[model samples]
Target chain A: MNFIELTDQPIDVAKVLQSVSHPDAGGEVLFLGTTRQFTAYPDSKEQDRSGDAGGQHTAFLVYEAYREMALKQMERLAEQACQNWPLKSVALVHRLGKVMPQEASVAVAVSSPHREEAFQAAKWLIDSIKADVTIWKQENSPSEDAQWVHPTNSGAAHE
Target chain B: MIQIRLFAGATQLAGQSTVELSPTDLPTNPTVGDVANCLTARYPQLQSLAAKSRWAIGSEFVELDCPVESEHSLAMIPPVSGG
Candidate 1:
């Protein structure tokens, strides 16, 4: 069963893993992209704005998407993965809005007849999602300061 | 009028998620670049972000030179930072 979704609900990793399970498949790969804390670097606009700059932990994240477009892009990438590999099923999902640290913000799951293709497709899907998907995230610091992660600017350095 | 959807940093800078601008201010048969130009002219704050943004139509991204109609759904895609 191929399952795809964008939700504000918490991700169930087990459910994602189960979505791709099939009797014919010998391997199933699931990757969860979880949120993690980051330190605010010096001279960042985020730093200057918050005045709580150097080395503060991020408390949470707020994610956004051009919803319809994000879903379309996810579907396109999932279909592309299937075309490039031999897979039985696929599950791609992302969380939107406020997500606490250590939460799974994104999940990619795939099943294939063999181990090799399953691993390959799972990696490709996650990488492509990072590159092409319309999803975006903001870092909410412990001080409640929020800064959008712009891949081209300061956050790009930390990333 | 062409409607533009903005997100993340672009939305933050524009102070709104979406905006509609009359195409009358643009040249005849305006292209994606023209739309972008008109937007930046109206919201100069978007200029910096626009340097790295991508103009998209439907599910596919379009070049700045591509022609667009008022009815088309257009979006400005900023440098994405998703997991």
Candidate 2:
């Protein structure tokens, strides 16, 4: 079964993995994305606007989505992945609402008859979701006001 | 009337989640670009976003010049940040 969901609750990685488990599948790959304390916005001049150009700390991140659109796009991506790979199943879950540091915000699992296909599909699914989904994240920083992160511009920075 | 939904920073800038426009406000058989131009004119704050954002009819993203039906759901999607 193909599974797709957007929820306010924390993502259950194990459940997502189990949902894609199949006897016919020889390989399964899971990817987890967690909220981090440091985030950098390379495309935006927001850092300068906040007067904290050198340092920015994320207290938390609040995720929001155009729900119906996001779900539809996700389902489309899942279908595309399945068509591109010989897969057993696919599961994708993204968390909405406030996600604290170190909390899992998204999870993806893909199972296939071989490791290569599973790995490729898993990577493609996550990358496509990041690039195409209609979800947004607001980074709340202690030193500066909150900013809505632009998809292509922002990335987690190790503190 | 057509309702244009806004999300993320676009919503924050416009100070409203949705913008309503009468068909008379746009050109005949308005394209997505025409709708965007009308919105920017009505809400100058949306100008910058309108320039960069993608347009969506219902759940599908469309080209700026794509024809829009007044009855369809529309949204201005700022750059997505999903994981």
Pairs that collide, model 2: none
**Residues A1-159, candidate 2, lDDT per residue (tens digit)?**
799999999898888999999999999999999987866554446545444444458999999999999999889889999999999999999999999999999999999999999999999999888887899999999766888876544322200
User: Which residue pairs collide, candidate 1?
Assistant: none
- Worst lDDT window (10 residues) for model 1 chain A? A150-159
Highest lDDT model number: 2
Give TM-scores for every candidate, taking all chains together and pairing residue i with residue i.
Answer: 0.90, 0.91
Docking model 1 quality class: medium
In candidate 1, which residue ranges exceed 4 Å CA deviation?
A: A39-56, A153-159
> What ranges in model 2 sit over 4 Å off?
A44-55, A151-159
Q: List the DockQ of the predictions in order.
A: 0.61, 0.62
